[model samples]
Target: MSTVVVTGGTGTAGRAVVNALVAAHHDVVVTSRSTSSVHGRVRTVRLDYGSPADLEAAFHGPDAVVHCATSFTGVRGGETELGRRVLAGARRVGCGHVVSISIVGIDRIPLPYYRAKLATEKLVENSGVPWTILRATQFHELVTRLLSGLTRPPLVLVPDIPVQPVAAEEVGARLAALAAARPAGRVPDLGGPEITTLPALARSYVAAIGRRRRVRAVRLFGSVFAGYHAGHHLAPGDATGTITYQDHLDAWVRTRR
Candidate 1:
């Protein structure tokens, strides 16, 4: 059993990664800046990203590191730099492998967040930490979250764009597998089981919650939307995920009830 550390292990993808590692019977440590109720079997540690010594200490003893910590909006001194810190810390402790999760179409999309992710990918490539990068499509939970942002009263406005959202757990499982093995550079892109319009996904989510809200598709403008509209963010060729969006909402609704 290897000691595997997951950064941002409380968030959606990070939490899923931590769970998979624990299920695999690996020694798991979660590093987070924030606190949340996590698995009892998993150990949580607070990391001072600002302190190099502390970061190096946090990096100690992990056989591998699965980097899921991220923020696209440049919050808290920019999420793009988190990769650099993680690399430095991992290198300091001589961690064998560092697996970083990234989004699909980051290279093609011009969104600020995508730009930041692309920059981080570059950092990981040159970090000299024996790294592996897995690019996956957006998560089903993220799609729901975005749709929630569009919710205005009784109507949920959704952009007219095609999306293929993979399950967070599936991506986490893949990352765990990668963490257990030697560094393999960039792997194949992972996407959802099927492609669907954003409005369709929103409608399903609204129905799952028993909400009487109408899901209306709106044509958004700008280069970001243009990229989405052109399906630059889609991975139709790699429908490697098995769980459907409906399956995701069904499980989520059960948790709420």
Candidate 2:
């Protein structure tokens, strides 16, 4: 079995990717801040990225590394810093293949977080390691989280923009396969099976949660929203994900029961 390491093995996307790797019979090493976040047969380790020795030691003897760790450090370059640490560790350990996950519209949108994501992507491409990068649309969980935050009691005001929210598990599965295979540069963008507007998604989320709120879609003009309005963030051409947003909601509700 190939020895593969996942950087953020406990987070939403990372957890799914770890599960996929385990199912594929790989000797998986997952990194988590808390030991309680890890389980199953895979090896779990804590990493302190600031310490070069600790990072190098964590990365030692891995066939491949799937970097699912993400920090939404807008404009400050913290996201790219995280990537730099990971790449340095991998290069030191001589890991053969490195796979990274990114967002689909980071190149098209000028939002601070998206800019940070794009910067991280550039870092991976130029890191001198055999690497593969997968840019996917937003995850269903993220969309729901955004909507939840916007819901202020009686009403939810969402952007008048379209979204394609894919399942984290599907993206993780794809990343796991990429991690095991040869490093092919940037792969096709993965997206949801359907294209939906923010207001519609918010309405569904509110209904699913049994929250009494009216959802409204308002147009907010900006370079960011313009990018969204132009559908630059969408992936209708690469809508390969199978899980629907409703499907995610149903499964989430079950967890709360």
Candidate 3:
């Protein structure tokens, strides 16, 4: 039986990947800083990506490894370091393929997190190990939250930006498929069915949830605005998602209602 190791099994995207891989009858092992809600046919391995020793042990003997961990609170070099450590461990253990999930528009976004993600991609490519770099758009849930606190005095000040967000579940399925196959350097970018602007998305979300709030689109006028207008944060035309934003939003509303 081929075994696949998931590095961020507790995250939104990683959990979905684990479930998809397990459903396909693959032996799956998950590694995280702490234990997750483990399911049947999934074994949890405790690992902190910064520590090479733990990474080496968890990565050893796996057929393929999927790296989905993100260092949110650490220093600027944290994500890059994690990627380096994971790749080093994978190569040492003779793992065949490594699939990494990355953000779209990371190179031109100029955000600290995006910069780290971009650096990590280069790290994986130069690691001398077979790898797949899957760049995906924002998740629907993330966009929803960004809109949550924007209402102020009957006006919603959402930054003007384009987005094609995909559901977390779809991304997970794609990652599992990538892990089970050979490295595809840079795969087609994945995004939602329709492109929606940030302000419009916020309005739609507010309306759907019966918030009775008026969403007022505002132009961004700073480094952040420059990134927003540059369209560096959106996926290109070649890659599109099967699920629509409306479908995701409706489902999300149902879950909360």
Best by TM-score: 2
| Predicted candidate 3 versus true structure: per-residue lDDT over 1-257, tens digit per residue | 57899988878889889989988888888997876445677889878777878888888788799999888643355888778888999998888999999988888877777888998999889998999999999988788777777753477778878888888888999999988887899998887777779888887888888887777777878775698788777776844678777787898899987
lDDT of 2 by residue, 1-257 (tens): 68899998889999999899899998888876666334566888887767789788778999999998878766464787889989999998898999999998889889888888898888899999999999999999998789889986686778899999999999999999999899999999999999989999888888888889988889999888899999998999999999999999999988988
The prediction achieving the highest lDDT against the true structure is 2
Write the residue-wise lDDT of candidate 1 on 216-238 in tens digits.
88999998889899988888888
lDDT of 3 at 194: 76
lDDT of each model, Cα atoms only? 0.86, 0.89, 0.83
Going through the candidates in the order shown, the clash numbers are 0, 0, 0
User: What TM-score, over all chains together, does every model reach?
Assistant: 0.93, 0.96, 0.93
Cα error, candidate 1, residue 222 (Å): 1.8
Regions of candidate 1 where Cα sits further than 4 Å from its true position: 34-41
Off by over 4 Å in 2: 36-40, 75-77
Model 3: residue 140 alpha-carbon error in angstroms? 0.9
Candidate 3 residue 212 C-alpha distance from true site, Å? 1.6
Error of 3 at 18 (Å): 1.2
Residues forming the 10-long window of minimal summed lDDT in candidate 2: 32-41
